[model samples]
Target chain A: MSFPPLLEDLIRSLKVLPGVGAKSAQRMAFSLLEGDRLGGQKLAKTLAKAVDGIQHCTSCRNYTQSELCDICANPRRELNGEICVVATPSDVAAIEQTGHFQGRYFVLMGLLSPLDGIGPDELGLDRLANLMATTEVKELILATNPTVEGEATAHYIAEIAQQHNVRVSRIAQGVPVGGELEMVDGKTLGHAFSGRKTL
Target chain B: MSFPPLLEDLIRSLKVLPGVGAKSAQRMAFSLLEGDRLGGQKLAKTLAKAVDGIQHCTSCRNYTQSELCDICANPRRELNGEICVVATPSDVAAIEQTGHFQGRYFVLMGLLSPLDGIGPDELGLDRLANLMATTEVKELILATNPTVEGEATAHYIAEIAQQHNVRVSRIAQGVPVGGELEMVDGKTLGHAFSGRKTL
Candidate 1:
């Protein structure tokens, strides 16, 4: 039996999802057209809404709809004299899930990759500097990954923090080569970041 | 550092992506905030464009940019006694990828799972029945998966075709139990659907 043209388009577009190639897209398309209309509608609606509604936290560069994120706005987090620097808010949640760190986070959003023309400005190093200058934060923990890029980024930030009389430390051993914060486990992250040696 | 409310909402909202949990959402938020304004803008644009531009093919229920899907519109697909039935257009593409199954397709979209309240209408069986009545199809191959529900659906279609005086057959064996069409190798699918046994 032959169908009209409208059905084929929906099946093809589903291929855009990660790990979903042509075959999987067909399954998803069939499943949606056959089973999950609400799921499909929700996927379409929320994808757009999330993209449009979300923006970077001005202070830490975390995604936020309002002025501050949940961790940044919490008054209890302010009492801690430290700010954990990371490459993403996902890093923040990874740390927070452990229930170990009392301090809030300052997400770097990205690393300083000079080769890629990404500098301190692009990585929001100036934001960290501004925060150190204004706030009473004592320890600045660099929780970026252990990649060459991450190490270079940590060192770059450490040099700048030293200027503001801030104690800087990077996460120590535990992260494997080419590992990302998202892949690292919570228990290991606490050990790595807490046992960080002087950069 | 404390962030604003809107910023938090943005980060939190991103957690809803297919695999993105709270932490991943935060990471994405931070990534955007830290740098990669270009990447962020591109991601936003991609998401927006995909959602708005992608539509279902009227014929096969697959993803398409226009009214008719590429396969349905192609003149080459309209050769004699042609019309392969599948659960999705992905199946059509899979069969096409093998350079076999020269006939066009009718995507069943899904099996009839009455336990889930999915009947013929839900699976588009009625449209398929109507299609077979008018089309000059010489053979109808049931290319649905080998699942219990899929078998049941195949049986129901067989009965419907008997009433319509159409020659229908199920795809042949060698497909693993509970295996979906997308999971099987290309050669296997070509062999299985082509060698389908008559019900």
Candidate 2:
């Protein structure tokens, strides 16, 4: 038998989430309906609020409720003149959690994927260039992840920074801080050897 | 930096979903806010609709918008005199997908967990007894999971059926159908041996 109209619509709508399949969607539907009606109401209200209110920061493309995100609006981050270019907003959050980088960020919003039609324009490279022209950005750190598309995106952004005479540096790729040498992958080991630093 | 108030609230509300942690909730919030605002709106509308409209079926306690759930409303399922009793709506979905069971279902909604303050009334065992008394039920097949609480719930409901002189049967427990015997756990192996049928 089929679910009632609204229940069916809810299950279908829930499948849009990443990693959630038909079975998982059904499980989530039952969980919310059977156990937490208040939670469901809260989720609905929160989702509506976020969807209606949130917008991308004009300066950095990160999600924000105002014209500028907190990081972009911070006076200290603006003066730092160090912009870390990342693939997505989640990457911005990851770097922020580390508390090591005290500068700003530029969210590319996507990686370069020729097959998927995500080109320089799709990654908002032109917007990055415009931001570079308007600000006293001294350095551009390419912090895109190490994959084929990520590498292409980083290189593309590096070229853009070079055109603006801005110094470009890639985040070090090697053995992670606490990783075991034995567990490190072959390509990373190779990069570690080739990009070794002198004390 | 912390998320804005609405975003933070959305993330926290999302955590009430089963298996969603802080990181996952944040990701979901960002995904909805950044790229899929329409999806967020859809989810919100659907969730609100389901929560507000859906109600338990009077006969089977399964989710429904009408007085009776689809299964209980169907004349064919009602006349079959076979009631498959399960602990959750997901179980009903699983059994229905198999297409082997033509009879109706009785959803217990939860297992008997005395430690957590869940007892017979919480699982609605009295309601099951009432349904059995009123309906032309010939067999009560206990389809609860293989966990301890599931077992207790099944036995409790079975006793209830027995009190009304109704035949009660538990779904089999053993090594899974395609599972290797060598890799099977001891308790399941023991049940497999004890419940062996004549060749």
User: Which predicted model would earn the best lDDT?
Assistant: 2
List the pairs of residues colliding in candidate 2.
none
Query: Can you give the DockQ of every candidate in the order shown?
Result: 0.15, 0.56
Residue B159 local lDDT, model 2: 86
Candidate 1, residues A104-181, lDDT tens digits: the string is 788776777878888888878888899999988979988888778988888888898999989988766666678998
What is the two-chain DockQ of model 2?
0.56
lDDT of 1 by residue, B1-199 (tens): 2334444555555444455565555555555544444444444444444445566666655556787777767777755556666765556667777776776677765668778787888767777777678766677778788778878888888898888888888876667779998899887787778777789
- Leading candidate by TM-score: 2
Chain B TM-score, candidates in order? 0.73, 0.93
Per-residue CA lDDT of model 2 for A4-121, tens digit only, reads: 7888899999987767788888889999998899999989988888889888788888878899999899999989999999988778878888898999999988899988788988
